[model samples]
Target: MFTYVMRFLFCLLTILPLSLYAAVGDHFYYADWYYEILSETDMTVANLGARSASTPGLVYPTVEHNNKVYTVIELRKESFSSSYTFKNVDFTNYAPSSYKIKKIGDDVFNGTAIDPNTIPPCIEEIGARNFADRNDITSVTLPSQLRILGSSCFQSCANLQSVKGNFHLKKIGDGAFFMCQKLKTVELSYSVEDIGNDAFVSCSALESLIMPSAKTLGTGAFQDCPKLTSISLPSNLVSIGESAFLYCTGLKSIVIPENVISIGKRAFEHCDKAEYILFKPATEPAYVNWKGEAANFTDCFNADIESKMYVPSRKTYEHGIEMISFEDKPLTYTGLSPEISWKNNTPWPITVDTSNLPKTAGEHNVTLTAAFQNPSISLNIPYTFNIVKAPLKVTVNNSERVYGSFDQNYSCSFEGFVNGESESTVKLDLSYVTEANYQSPVGTYPISATLTPANYEPEVISGTITITKAQSTLEIQNLDELSNLKTGEGVIICWISNAPHSELSLGSETTASVELQKMSTLTNGEEAIQYRLIPINPGEGKVGLYASGSHNHEDAYTEFEVKIEDKAGITNVHTDCVSLITRPYEAIIIGKADNAKARLYDINGRLIHNGIDNVIRVAKRGVYILIVNNSRYEVAL
Candidate 1:
């Protein structure tokens, strides 16, 4: 009766649905002899061993009836533990046949003691070490929404033939499908730009490749892929990073599109079989060496040589191109009316006539040919002929013309050319208008010559002629004019231009040159002030102010009026140093009052000073009174 009751309880437990389990005791646990092999949950190990409790979600347990232990976990639960022993959980019915997978819950399966079986299709993202060495997976269709294939996802899956569409995949994570030797084919997404280094390194079966329009290729991307034959570089790529295609020995040729500006060193270095490395015509410097500098040789050509015109020496060729000049003298026609025809001397024919010739002078036409020595090519070059004649007599006409102070100068002449039969003449003319009134104007005038005759066309030539007014004279207008004169005043008055430098004069000191050194002025009741102009270069002659200096000075002084008198009778006579004014020198004193009185007398009692010129004129200069006390000084010269 107890056996019957225990059997009934076992049957009832199998019929009732299981609930999610947590604690070991709460799981559906049974005694070692009470094991049952049921598929109520559609799992081969449904009741392989007795459990304490049932779980709601997927319950993947490694159940072995012999061990009477089961390790289970609820799919929806965050944590759970597995049992140590199980029994009767083996798929002995499909032993060594590779089929033990069973569905325990919706879209869930347990490798429950992972029995070489087809994993449920809903398993999109496989965890690490999931099926590392499992060779049963010959082909797996990864979930379409599966973008990341974790490391070692299908590593060492020796039987993996191909990866089913992983369409939304952007990256094949590090070592995701590593060492899957049977992975001979793959349809990578267009969006995968970077195939990490060594990611496809040993993919020996990969022969042809199509790189996406990625800007830079990672290192060793295709290293050791010996079967790779040819490649087409993308138009927008700037560089192929290090060893990108190293050891691709079978590559024959590559078309490096112009847009690919740089190819990293050793990128295709070991692609031994490649013969024709073609690149688009680079607009800028293209090839770069190991040190990242520009490569030199663009194009090269061979050379061939024949006799006279040899190609330049090799040394000349390397530095720069060479050039030559040929001089051909006139060829004489000694034969009677010879038709000068240059034959096979050149690739092209050339001819000239010497038939209508003169007895004394001969005419000749020379032909030159240029050849490309390298390719043995030549072409004819042509030039003209000339007949000799006696030298012509050339001469300048209109030799001279008298130019007025303000007039234009004109002259004309002709050259005589005599050929014994007809004589030709060439005329020359000098003609130009003055720029200003030459009483010599402030600047020079340009003289121009024009040539004309039957044979010569009109031509012109020119030169500059300075214009300036005459003498070196001073015209002191007033005492105020000399007020701003300082130490530099003497230096300024030393070099007075636009006048005769030799005839230069100032004050009453007449000499070749006059400089007012340490000079000062004094006025007595003012009609005019007197400044003694001392001579620095002198022969010692009578002194007087010339008209030029005063008129041309910065103040434009006109003249001065004064009276000369005897120095002995002059009051207020002062000079720290004697000879300062050439003592007893011609005195310069302004009119004391409106009608100032004045007189002049030599030490010998003769009056050589007078107001005759309104400018006190003295035969011999000596200290004398410039009397302004006399009547208003007027010219007494």
Candidate 2:
């Protein structure tokens, strides 16, 4: 009773609150864009600012949402430069007037409560510090369409372990993952072109990096990263920023890309353990931010650390080219070396990248890098090649069509795509054709399934379509002859038709005078079925045969009369033709009766089915007579 009373009061309080003054719409700009719009579609939301209630409101007097009206409150104006405090309005359900959010503006999420975990695939850009200082977040898998990460977007995400899925990302803003101490791995998309200043600074746990398309490294981009054992730079890299690897002590060796034009001051200042440095370019690049004249090469590394350059006799170059078959596995560098230097006392190790190779057949380029622990040699090799598409298998599934059907209901399936691709990745033009038509006779016809392939060789696996004769007509041989049935006399009404609708049915009038018994299917398969009907009373009635049809067919029905006279036929006769039973699958015939010569005939006096042992079975409906010992007997089998 108390709970019900409280619930009633609560409902009353809720209803009266709608008239209260409240704010709505973009009152505080809590989100960079409306959360509902950002998470709902492939549309871009831009210029989303962090939530702020610092600016006083004086415009609205009313707001409507979900068909309920609320009075808006007015507040005194405040200075634009006034210090702001975090205060969010209940505008989660509010939609901005426009949905064209295209780019995340700078400093938009500096102090907001929004979580960046649900960034939709349609979102292409992220503003700086959007998720900075948010230690609660553990992982971030960016959308495939995201093109850029704003400066410090996820900086100080202490729990972040992996950052991936940004297949189209081109740039990483300054300090994007700065101080993210736990970040272990970074999977740079092949399209990434630049890494900004301090982008991954102080990411102490980072271990691996493979940037295949990167062109530049900004100042302090990877400063203080001690766990990065190796870095894969692309052939397109043009510059290395200052303090880039200042304290990357774990890097035992480094490779200067052949295209690098400049190296900032102290680029590898504290990389004391570095023993090898190889310059791939034939000419020395301008050592910007260094002393007036050319200092020792070790100046790029620790002052005490020795770094040597090797002149090339055995230079790195592209291998002989071959068009890759789509069916062939991704190419590996296990046996191929871009550079071999026997002059160096220590063995030079070459890294053949078999992993991250493109899976789909197409024209692609890869960077071949070789580095050594001593002499500090760096070599960058760029190789371009083509992958020829393999033959694709298209099978037109086997089908069955009605002999005269006009239904061009054809279907096909496709087989064979690479691990990273599917049929949807290619333009498929599938067409199916057969020589058979509606007037064609019943038989099998060949069907060809063809496709135009752009990335794959077209290999068609032909199929067949079988034209089956339709079961349009029903026949009961002696149906009209079943009008008269004696009291003890029974007839086996064989239900014959290609279409199996239902068992033989008796009309109300006939059903009242006769007892219908179920029987087995004859040797002719489903086309022949038998039913035994013995009259129990004298009356006139009707029997009906009905069938429902499928496509290109029509329903069928027929009616016949039946008359039963209340009199037994040879009920006292001690001789019978056969002791019969009706099992659905097969017939069970006992030994013949009386050991006499016997023959059976239809009502038209035609001979019954020809079988051994003088046995008679039902295959068609008719009046049957048994001539045994030249004596006559009538019964149903």
Candidate 3:
């Protein structure tokens, strides 16, 4: 009977009477009542923006055809604000106060023109019917510290378009915001736990809701909310009251969480467009009304859904793949057990147990398991896996040597070894072979390398041995002390080059002439030539001997000076060099010219021994001696 009376009064107030109109607009304008009539205004004000209108609905539709001559523009209709009777009237400004409000008493401003926006944030609770039946407020912002929204607080507030909420709100009282048709969204904070009966009923423009922390939805809480297409029932919600979603028709799917053990009768009665309802629990939730009336889960659904409800299971497979340890890939188990490939035949997903799966590389027998709590079922299967060795490539690097030089120092390197393992662990038989020998002609020869391993597979890349033509050089020998030669005496200059069949040419000169003595070629790619240089004239000059290579690779050059004495001296003793038996380290000679004398000194030009009779005294052993007559002769004894 009380419920009927409240609904009856809610319909009756839509057409408010004169007595109620006088009471509804008793709101404060700044600090005074909004209904206080100022002096009647026959003269119209040009700038309405300057009007001191602080209270809502104080000057609604201030200038329009509804204005009457005798009727003063009362800022308040007093009943159901903005009932549209506005005439010109005067407004007065009042001094605003800084008073702090903590709570609003019940019916303090019920069915009156109180603005929800004007409620100070210091207030923590709003009394029932505080702003009910008011047409001026377009939105409701809950106070920051407010925890409870009293029943019917904003009910029948026809123009209420939205409701802003905060995390501190814990409950929405019954019939709060009822019949607010323009409210499109209900995104309350997660701290809200209870939605009282008829809390948002007949909110036709409501399309979505997100109060996932709510545990109980009261009777008729969301009844007749037709535009709502989706609603996420809180995971912690234990009960949904009767007719909670009675006439909502736009929903396409419904998911009942495992915590929900009971669904009230007619809770989802007219949601005919919903294609499926997936229940997470194994058995259907009891569909009985809270009054202890017996009912089935199918009884609440529309006729289009009674035959479509059914329970199903899923499918999965277990197997393993062949891999190698040398590939440097290691395996560890994540509890999800990726080995068992699943094929779920239902709308929901399931998890698998990997406790028996392998964590290291080897051949092992394992089992995979999957369990489904809803429509309870379990699957177990056996499988096997193996790890093998990886293949590798070893190569002997290319080698280079001269044509006549032998170099057997062949080197090698490896590729495709993983996990820090090298050739030391595996026995290897590696051989490098080529067709070229130490005496082979200059050319590039292919060297094929092979490797046979005991514990691993092997591949090879062939290399090459290049025989390069050696550098050729020429040098004129016995020319170091060939100075002051007499006209009748000559000295042999021995020349040699590393290239066979090589020839040496002398540049034109004035002081000397050369006679070819002998030429020879040896088996080791060496060429030799001997030239005897005889001093012809007294003037001294330089002569150049240049050699060209035989194998077309090497070239060489040499230079030396020759001098001839004008006077004829005693028969040639040893100015250049002589054997130990023929010319001893001490030589004695008497010249026809009494002025001819020879003096000997050590290698440092210090006088060691001397002879005045044209005799030269040199060291007895192989120490060097410089014999000075008209010129110095460096002789090694």
Task: Estimate TM-scores for all models.
Answer: 0.31, 0.39, 0.38
Runs in model 1 deviating more than 4 A are 1-146, 156-168, 177-186, 213-220, 232-246, 254-270, 276-441, 445-543, 546-637
lDDT of 3 by residue, 532-587 (tens): 23234445544444444222343454444433333322122322221111123222
Please, what is the whole-model Cα lDDT of each candidate in the order they appear? 0.38, 0.53, 0.53
Which segments of candidate 2 are over 4 A away from where they belong?
A: 1-100, 290-296, 304-346, 349-637
lDDT for position 593 in model 2: 19
Per-candidate RMSD, Å: 23.0, 27.8, 23.4
Model 2: per-residue Cα lDDT at residue 139: 78
TM-score of 3: 0.38
Candidate 3 local lDDT, residue 360: 34
Best by TM-score: 2
- Tens-digit per-residue lDDT, 1-637, candidate 2: 9999999999988888553433322232222211111211222111222224743211122334334433322111122432332224223233332122335455454555555654344557776776798877777888667788889998998898788746799999999999999998888888899999999999999998877888888889999999987887788888887778889988877767778877777888877666655556534565555332443345566655432333222224121111111122343222122222212233454343345555445667665444543444445444555566766678888998764467888877777765455667777787787888875655788999777766677778788998765432211243332333223323342323243533334322221223222211211122333333333334666645444412223255454454443322211122211112232222121111111223334333444432212222222332232212111112333
Q: Score residue 236 of candidate 1 by CA lDDT.
A: 53
Estimate, for each residue in 155-263, the C-alpha lDDT of model 1 and write its tens digit.
5667766665444554554445556666655555554444454455655655545544445455555667676676656555565555667777887665455456655
Q: What TM value does model 2 have?
A: 0.39
